[model samples]
Target: MSALILTSVLGVVLLYLGLSGNKSILAPTAIVGLVAAGVMSWTGWNPGLMEFPTMLKFDQMSTLFNCAMIAVTVLLFLFGIDYYRRMEENVAEHYALMVFSLTGALILTSYTNLLMLFLGIEILSIPLYILAGGKKRSYRSSEASFKYFLLGSFATAFFLMGIALIYGVTASFDLAVIGQKVQAAPNNVLFLLGAFFVSIALSFKVGAVPFHFWSPDVYEGAPTLVTAFMATVVKTAAFAGFYRFLQMTAMPPALSDTLLVITILTLFLGNVVAMRQSQFKRLMAYSSIAHTGFLLMAVLANSAMSWSTLFYYTFTYALATVGLFIVLTLAKRAANGNEAIVIFRGLFRANPWLALVTMLLLLSLAGIPLTAGFVAKYQVFMLAIGAGFIKTAVFAVFMALVGIYYYVLVIREAFTPAEETPVLVVSPINWLVVSACGVAVVAFALWPVLVG
Candidate 1:
């Protein structure tokens, strides 16, 4: 908990530095702090309590997520180095805000109390509100900021209310206490209702369907780097929280059924909608939502290796997304910042390596065999089938097939030849960013111990 607090405070200080116009220092400073904090988190990671009075855990799961979040942010910071250098004005604040948001993410991953969960969500989200609109002068950016703030606050309210109700029934905010109370009276309606409300709050945070209205617009409007932060780090933390919430016995069979339905709806909505998207960012946003559904399926299936599955899924997904977003930023720069799929047309002719890397990412996302995605999806399917939800698993398989089409479309465009030479210029750092992700994706696919 102290580590979480220190990192967040460091982030806040950095944000202050950023807004004060120290643009060049923002990324480097943040990178160093995150790396140090990440190391501390890893070294201290074990089954133990920190700030026991406040109720937070620093277990293997938390450590893994902390490491993953740190790594993702490091890459984003590196990408931002080149991506934001062009837009010099808000550079400082942008990096600072990202760090602050990451602080919130760390808390969300390790939180053990309902109060801490609420605090973590607020900390994580409020900075994002500003980050989303960091463009300062763009109407769409401002609009995205306002929309996300309003909806995110509404979700937070639900979360707080649920926490209150759960505290009322369980007479404590600690998850441990709540678990005891829940098992003691498994049929308690108020506890169940609180759990349901809490589920709603978490669902919104992760951008699951029916609560995913903010995603496409936000992804389309917000700066690309901000979108990547929300997509990878924010989603991962929320799922970690969501998984923790469902671990209690109070998550009744009826609630489980409801979650299963949500899983299916999210999958269907995310995939079917993404198929029609022309914008690459929007396609990825919807693709993320669909992936949430797949992740939730693993959550509902509830196996011993659920944590491992989640770790692999989110880690690989984040890696692929960070790489893809970097490529998108470069491609958009080449096309005068156009995000359309057509921007990638004949990309291979202009830069075969960039195009190939992009194709590999899309293929990984599609769960093509021999990629990390294949293993991730396969694990979920096995979990569902093992849990005896054959029908749900089968439907998920069908949706997986449906998802393949859109990813293939992206890949097809990447390989398509352009009439003009593509002027794709990548900095050494961004090139390293792309190469690192590519390597990690395949490296994990073959070794799998990268996760272990």
Candidate 2:
């Protein structure tokens, strides 16, 4: 796709531009490039690479995902303008690495071959390992980078082994051929084992439970921007790949049972554990895991509306998450880098508009009515019920209700009084992102056409 080529090229351009020692131009340049990439994706002008039918095809889902990833990245780079202003070096590297990671993500959404999937996952991940450690001076950042690298490496091994096993069975790595083989031998133990192993690797990528231990530590330790990128764009791509892999190829009954267990455990652990977290980022981390359970449910439903439901859920969740992280950044600064939820104390008094926007974003995340999050969850529940997963759907509802308490805790803190409330200073760009996210959620919900 032209957008894919453009993003890959843009990352390199940023690197070369970084050499000129004029750091001021990086974010704007990157944002402009991202916008152009997004335009190319949306317009359906995927020139070049048409001959490689077995490799990639930018169909509706992939194109939609590509555009969505590009759009969120534009938002991140916009925030990067302020986030990196105080940094001395490597600002361009940050922008460039994110673009490169995005390049891999685009590939993941479109890849038709297992080899391409492996390539895409590596391309998407290698940059993140570095970005997590971008804050070189922080020990926690170094720890995050190292921990993520080690665990991710292990996951990759499992993924590759699974691919090999599947190849061994089918004598091909092409998804279409593999699909045919899977149906030909539905009860083939080796194929199911391969699928199960692959599922574990993907679950690790998306932060699903049992494979989710790394998310909170990583989210809390990595630079918030990188964490936001992981939580949003990386997630969107991973789930899309996951749904495409399982659904398009036809999920085996054995694999469905395994996912059923995973979804329940992910729901139980993610919500129950989040209540114990006092740190803001850690809470968001577990909140993201809880969301993983919901997204897993969407994937499991495997209905005609599954992908649409997944995209809507992830995209809206991304908006809320990005805005909340910006809010957290501003609050953290005001509190002299304290990451506790207490940093938000008196936010309503210190900056009423920012605080109000914070409340709205939290509400959306908590699945409150009239917000996009609520609609997203409702759609998932309906889809699940329609698919005859009523027991699982009901359990999910209870967990969702459990999840709301933590979000409300943050919202309450924002609205509460403090003797020494940190004086948050929101930059206009940050404020705009926060307010826009808040409005977009409500706007998306009130409009019946979009919701329907």
Q: Write the per-residue lDDT of candidate 2 for residues 159-202, one digit (tens) a residue.
A: 99999988888899899889988888888888888888889999
Count backbone overlaps in model 1: 4
Residue 80 error, candidate 2, Å:
0.5
Predicted structure with the largest lDDT when compared to the true one = 2
What ranges in model 2 sit over 4 Å off? 48-51, 449-452
| Each prediction's whole-model lDDT (CA) | 0.86, 0.91
| Consecutive 10-residue window with the lowest summed lDDT within model 2 | 44-53
Best by TM-score: 2
lDDT of 1 by residue, 1-452 (tens): 55576577777778678766757787888888888888878788323444564567777888899999988999999898888887867677677778878888898888888887888888889999999998888998999999999999899888888888888898898888888888888978888788888899999999888999999999988999999999999999988888877886445887898898899899999999999999998999999999999999888987767878898899899999999998888888889978998888878887788788888888889999888888899988998898888998899899999999999998888887878766989899998899888888878787765556
Residue 391, model 2, lDDT? 100
Pairs in steric clash, model 2: none
RMSD of each predicted structure: 2.1, 1.1
